[model samples]
Target: MVKLIALYRHPEDQESFDKHYEQVHTPLVEKMPGLKKLEVTRIQGAPMGGEAKYYLEAAMYFADRAALDAAMSSPEGKASAKDLMGFAGSLVTMMIGEVSREG
Candidate 1:
């Protein structure tokens, strides 16, 4: 499996960010083709208990890198990309990786 991951930095307005994410961004992402699964996490604090650097983490699962690329090239993906740039472009870090689900 392959995964597209996004690490979101703390935004200036947390509430507004959350609202747009849940209401608009999520739906746009869900429309992506070849999406196997989507996992979103709200980061609370570090192991030492101060605070985590990132505010949220989103992982989008795909069958492989090809599927991921195809999905990202689709219309839905284009819309999501534009919306992302409008909102969290500067505050987000994104990566693609191969997944190993073995123990």
Candidate 2:
């Protein structure tokens, strides 16, 4: 499987960010054609009792890189990408990678 991981740093307004993320952004992401699963993480803290650099993490799963590419090339994907610019652009970091499993 391939996944698109998005790491979100703390935005200036936490409440607004959370509201928009849950209400608007998630729905847009769900519209992607090849999206298999979506996982979200609320970061707690870093090791050694320091602050965590990121506030939230989202993993969007696809069957493979080709599926992911197709999804991103679709109109829904474009809408999601454009929506990111509406909020929290500077605080987001995204990456795509293959999933590795260990038994």
Predicted model with the maximum lDDT: 1
lDDT for predicted candidate 2 compared with the true structure: 0.95
Query: TM-score for all predictions?
Result: 0.97, 0.95
Best by TM-score: 1
Model 2 backbone overlap count? 0
Model 1 off-target regions past 4 Å?
Answer: none
lDDT per residue (tens digit) for residues 1-103 in model 2: 9999999998889999999999999999999998999999999999888889999999999999999999999999999999987797899999998999823
RMSD of 1: 1.0
* lDDT: worst 10-residue window of model 2: 94-103
Query: Cα deviation in Å at residue 9, candidate 2?
Result: 0.7
> What digit string (tens of lDDT, one per residue) describes model 1 on residues 1-103?
9999999999999999999999999999999999999999999999999989999999999999999999999999999999999999999999998998733
